[model samples]
Target: MRRFRARRRQEPTNQMRYSSATDVPQVVPPPIEAAAGRVTESERRTSSQRFRGDIQGLRAVAVLAVLGFHTGMPLLSGGFVGVDVFFVISGFLITGLIDREIGRTGRLRLSRFWARRVRRLLPATAVVLVTVGAMTLLVLPMTRWSSVAWDIATSALYVVNWRLADQSVSYLASDDAPSPVQHYWSLAVEEQFYIVWPLMILLVLWLQRRYRLPLTRAMLTGIAAIGVPSFIWSIVLTKTSPGPAYFVSTTRLWELAIGGALAILAHRIPRLPAVWAHLLGVAGLTAIVLAVVTFDAATPFPGIAALVPTLGAAAVIAAGTVGRRTISDLVLDTPIMRDIGTLSYSLYLWHWPLLIGAAAMWGEDNELPVTIAVTVVGFSVVPAWLTHRLVEAPIHRAKVFVRLPGWAAVLGVVCTAIGVATAVIVSLAVPKQPSYAVGGEAPGAAVLDAIPAQDPDGRPADSVDLLVPDVLAAREDLATLGGEPCISELEGTELEACSYGPEDADVTMALVGDSKAHQWLPAFQRIADERGWRILTYLKSACPLARVDIKYEDRANQDCAEYNETRYDRLHELESIDYVVTSQVASQAYLGPNESQREQTDAMVEDLRRTWTGLEDAGRQVIVLVDNPNPEHEVIECVAEHGDELSACAFPRAIGAERGGAPAQLAALEGLDGVSSVDVNDYICPGDMCPAVIGNVLIYRRGSHLTATYVDSLTPRLDEALIAAMR
Candidate 1:
């Protein structure tokens, strides 16, 4: 899973966007002699099936675009548009099938239609789930097992899209890795459509029969009623909360409805002249290509931007319907394209997990080479072909419950049960925290001084077993800082204030900044409790207290600027505030126009000087706690994977120094009166090498923030510094 940061939005993978509907074969006419009204096997086949060679080719195009995008091809940054194409295709085929059935027979066979869908899709899906589940336990780290298992379970139930939508907006799971089954969200959306659409058609047909209304009119009315509101909601939500809007089903229904409307109006649409058909086909293909090349992760999606691809797909389908031989018919009907289309469903299922599993086996930084990615995609054919032959074909061909016994239905139930049970057991077995003997005294200054320095290779000599629990449970430790309304959100500018310590204490010390300031709350609370001092907290997620504006997701963060102004005014109004403490991750700051790095540094120093001078003029003391060293990678994940040889996770002090705290703080507070700066980097990165563990404690939780357990151990040193600053 890509880490979710407010400024660095991770683009969703292909699985969240791509799904392939199987091709329905053309049916031969049945002989007369059956009952006049009774539906024969041939009549049922003809009603529900069409051999659209052009559509098959389109499936091939959709899957390949998704594959190219996922494998890191620079040319296909907008490869995500392939999903829009898929939605159009799904709407067209499904609507066409339903309409044909109505034309051939007076009433729809809802039970038989659903049964066919199960045989066509479920068997292969179940097999893939079981295989992926087994691979997850064997290949992925223990930390990811629980999340993946739940994803698998929900995927089997066909409701994982909703789960992903919730996770997308959740602050707690923001940095969670992508699940192997994350791709199932798109499939879930399609399945939801499959279930609801038939019922909607049933309603339309009943109304048409009861009132003697035209079928096409009724169908069009039903589609418009659902689609119009959904499109409006999609536009609004994409601006407000893109993460959830991208995964939720309702936001995407309009694209599918476009295809459904096309299918209903296919006959009424005029037959195109050869020149016009050719031009429409070429233009449509061009639009799709342009969207794929130009769009990127930053584009506001499934809103107005989605029109490029969805409308393009609709144009191509419409062109092919009227023309004698359009470009799609002639070019897309090749052997390779048809074969790939035949295997598209299985291929879509297999590709994503393979990519995720490969990332897990290797480190996240290792870019999957083009050759290896191609080979991996090629290897997918084996499982895909096997699944199609051994599972999908057998179930569909068995014709069980149609005319034969109910063996196929029984088999489907058993497979579903097995899949559910496997997911449950695997999820439950994942340990929340590693087993470590839980008794360790907090190391005081004397104890810290006695610890041995790093070896020549920069590896710590002490045992790291005590830190295992903290590493395994880093997220829990991070939660000690109150979340949500207590601390302002990343996009929020609200001046929310929280307090700790005795309410009646005379001395009131205020802590303010972004998350970096929040990290020190546990230690500050402990110090306040011991000394009977009151602690006030005003913290935001990504916003720092610096006067300079910052950018988030490629746009200026106006909210952060507003929050800083409000906080400054609030601080000035509090006459009894005796001390102010501030710290922030300086690496998050960026320069404004005409501001060079040196100029920005000078500007920051001036801002601090002004703020500190104001406090001093008001007779209040200020302390600047320097930010901690940020590791090059996620240290907790590194520690979890390399517990035996923890030295492998040690980051060079030179690199940490270049990227982090000391220089920035020294420059900002140089020669400033009434402001005292304190750095704990010596304790964190002892002997010029920042090992993952120090004094048998995990140093940093996610990237730079100190774990609450480690911060608790730093109480003595922090107390000494604060008392000296006040004096």
Candidate 2:
């Protein structure tokens, strides 16, 4: 299933008591309150220094948004923004703790602080990791074991955010099953922030000591120094690449910095008038509520759009500086709200796994129906409560862990090792086998190509228990161009001039378009090697040769069309001696937003025709290879699940054709002379039915991209098509 397309997951707070987790930690005990007229030393402290129950209320609000979003509650469509809320809260809490500690004491005790964090955060995290590890082994199929195992291990190591961020940018893994621990990315970000912020605080403190600078000014300056560039990058990167930008710490640091800045400013300014504070609080709540209801997965996140929620969270915290007399505290600090806030971290950790695991059990990765989703989240509370009571609270309050920071450090190491060990053990449990090579045993596409299946869907009756490429290994079966990846990255149109042919060959041909064009590389390379023709490959992921907008990952990918602009222009300059062959995987789903799919298809076809016409005008004979059939779901997983009944993976030809680029290819080629097109549907989907496996070969790999081994098997047919086009 597409990972988190319908919802977003966040785990930011380290569950502890309100005083320990989010309150402005007074360096000393017994916080002083001002009398009716006179006051305590203004420089010594600030207002709202007591345990802020409202911050806990903010946690409750954020986690509720998370619950609503994950459970497919329509009102919380933009619930993913909850992560920003948590980040802001965490920033305020942690930065205040550090700043206050340093202000009172000459030195900041890093070891004790880290120990406190570890004791508070690690036990529950480790428990969840072990639970997920156990679930993967016992509940999930062997096909998902490896990926999820690594995910668990990384979560244990607090690096899954990086793992997820990298995968988010990757085309091959984009549509794969999400890790149950995917929500841990926020925790990872916080952990990394935890590591960095102290150093930053120390630097700020050092600058104050060195230059005799004012502490508040230095702190604010330090926050601005880190936060300004980060916010700028967040905005820029979100526009071009939203996936990584969402998970990467650099893109999200500004939210935390905003909170830090608020903390410092709160101390410097006098407490706000009650009416203004209440107004600010109400406006802040309104901003957060507006974002939760109105924003969606399509909204560019943690960028300029993110400012609404992050600043709103900051606004709420800032308003709280007036000390709970305000309207926000009235609603936010009710017993139930504060109680939920106390349990929020555990709730965040437990909810996603239960939801994902239950869905995985039911053979789905998409958002569950609202009723069921809500039921699952509701069910999650039992474990969340149990964990909070049993694991989180006891360890957090333990003085043994607190006084002896080394013991807490050791406990963290042990927990981390347990997570890693679980991953290794689970990985070992999965059966390992070398992939089947195309030979007498695995004929791949050869058997069906030799004799078309008499059966309605050309599924040759094979009595093999195991498929060639292992089910788990199928998605990574990407075709290579020359010696490099044929498709350029999603963000850039930088094409490599990788030539595939004998160097002495006089005839030069180029294979161009999106990854659909890349899938035919093996066949074309075989043809080039045999027929003595030089072929150049220019392929970009989701970028077609057409000049139309594309909607990928549910957002309008302006980059794809913009990349095409630069690419098609450069294609005009590649006055290479001869032919330019191309294909596309573009479907109605991939086309830019329009009132109707027909209009989108027509506009796409027009642009595709224009693109092809230009290539033809450049003295290059163009051969458009008709795109292949696409199944609604990935086939290998189905193949794995129903090894005894492979027919479960077959789909109707009509459905497959509509999902592929065949209709668009046919339309673009119509009424055009000198340009030839070839349809391999007879081989790919025989007798009006498309089967997942044809002639012992898995037809599709990632998304609709054809497997190299299968494409290799169709070499002779593609050679004939190329020859016919030349004729």
Candidate 3:
């Protein structure tokens, strides 16, 4: 766009300035067959419409920011908000199309509209799903294969967002590997929204005809009816339940609605002056940049915090429709930006999987070298461009779909099935967990615990080739007492103690602490069953028995404190629960900020001593079960990838035990009244090296936690230690 003081001046047309369908071309929806559920709509634009280069440029910025974040660029830590930007853009474009369609036809041709969407989005998505499925088998660990398979199926049907939302809050799922198709969540949300938004508009139109109401006013009312409740729910859920809040559709509905409302009224509101448009555009761009740089993984999202980017995107869109030249014209309307924007959807789909594959192959996470990062980014564009040229563009613009949308519907089902089939194949390949333990002379600790010179049965470490539990099945190898979890969930504040052994046993023991204590139940349960002793377990995720100022989920964890206090009161009041045992995953516990490692260790030890002394005062004999060695990261995942060379994954015991709280637990009990400490780590590691597998059993699961089978092997040693500590 340009302005001149000379003769003639050419200015951009505000294409959104339509009051009636007569002002725009009528949409010709293709014929279609299938109906969708709680519809999730793909992005759509009106045919033969005026080109808004500024909007395309905005799309470029959004994708680039996301790419920057995914490709190991720390500067754009908050760039994940690019998905929010896309939602606003989708809402505005789709709503305008709906309003225009109703104006011309007096009704929505839903099947035809769905047909067009299918042809436009499904082909590219299915192609990516198949490619990712093959990649998963070739590169990723088999443990990840089954989940990624489900991810593919859900993504194909545009429901991965719901799946991710469910998983986000599950304590069991928190440590699972990230699926390559995780980014499809945003697409799922949009599709689900489009399904409902159109129906609401149709209802509003029906009411408008009966009441003689202005169409725009009725639509605005409809927008508010959905948007307001969603915004309030977003805030509440974000504060109390941040995990699910990030991925759920209900929390994000308001952002799209804001875009829809703007599309309806942008023409009605007076256009901004050129100078004001420039300033507003600059402001919006600046706001987006600031958000991209500042926000991080710990940032509570899709709540009130979302307003900055969503509103900033809205401002840019609003400011861009000024007809006169603005600051956005100089930045957003370039040829390069428009070209990238045209391939944006494909780029979004392809980039994440490529990055994930890169991580599996050579990188731990997003810590790739600059050269590797640039290569991955460059390669991602190749597939995006190829997909656009061969699949997305051709199928979307094809004449056959224009004539027969019914075929498009059929093709969409087949495409979705291909993704489901991929999932089924992967599921079928998942190695079943053997009911009985599978290799050596009661292997694991016995070999390692042997005195090197005297023990004839001891074999060299990592000698066992055949694994007891297969790598894929090791995920289910959880520590259990009577087939139930010992720990309460991350959000749980209750003191619901699970009882084990006989109800009328003469000896009653209480086990209290976090997941670290939960991991010991397999061995403890054996000890209880043999000794005819009853056990009461009070455990919570990340809530150690230590009375420390713990932080979780980016805030002060009042729940941990509340639960610990409740547990203390119960132990004090109950005379029957005379014996107490506890341990913690100290390195895993997130303490307050700005503290050195030594400072944190001191604080944790002090808290532990204080907590156990209280137990001693209650006349309860206290035994601190020493925490296991922390491999610091996922050792099972490492084993799965390098199963043949098991020794490669073996970490040093000294380092792991330090990372765990072995030293801290001992320090807490040093000369403290009635409090005794028991260490079974010698049986666990038994030497300088912490073998990834011992006695053919996998030692770690997803995190640093020990496998139940391995813990079961330590039962006799653990029982001996407990008896000694009791005396």
On lDDT, the stronger of 2 and 3 is 2
Model 1 C-alpha lDDT per residue in residues 1-727, reported as the tens digit of each score: 2221111133445453322334433221111111123346565455335556666777777778777777767677777777788888888777766766665665667766666666677788888898888888888767667777888888888888888878765545655667777777778887788888889888887787689775567779998887888899999877766777788899888888998888776654434577777777777778888888888676777789989988988887777665256776666667788888778788888887787777667534424565566567778888988887787777777745567435555665776676687798778768755634566743522246554433344446445445533555775576353332356765555799987767789889988877778888777878888899988888877676767665444334566788989998878788768888888775434465345767666666666678677766777777888887778777777777787778878888878776655466667687886688777666667767788776677777766777777787777778887888884
List clashing residue pairs in candidate 3.
31-405, 39-191, 40-191, 40-192, 41-191, 444-695
| lDDT by residue for model 2 (337-413), tens | 88888888888889888877777665343445667767888998999999989988888888898567899999899
Per-residue CA lDDT of model 3 for 161-251, tens digit only, reads 7787777655577567678888787888787887888888878877977997766677789999999999999998877766667777899
| lDDT score for residue 370 of model 1 | 59
User: What TM-scores do the predictions have?
Assistant: 0.85, 0.91, 0.87
- How high is the lDDT of residue 293 in model 3? 89
Candidate 1 contains a number of clashing pairs equal to 2
User: Model 3 misses residue 596 by how many Å?
Assistant: 4.4
Candidates in order: C-alpha RMSD to true structure? 5.3, 3.9, 8.7
| Winner by lDDT | 2
Cα miss at 2, model 2 (Å)? 14
Angstrom error of the Cα, residue 597, model 1: value is 10
Q: Lowest summed lDDT over 10 consecutive residues: which window, candidate 2?
A: 28-37
Query: Per-residue error at 492 for model 3, in Å?
Result: 3.7
lDDT at 282, model 2: 92
What's the lDDT for candidate 1?
Answer: 0.70
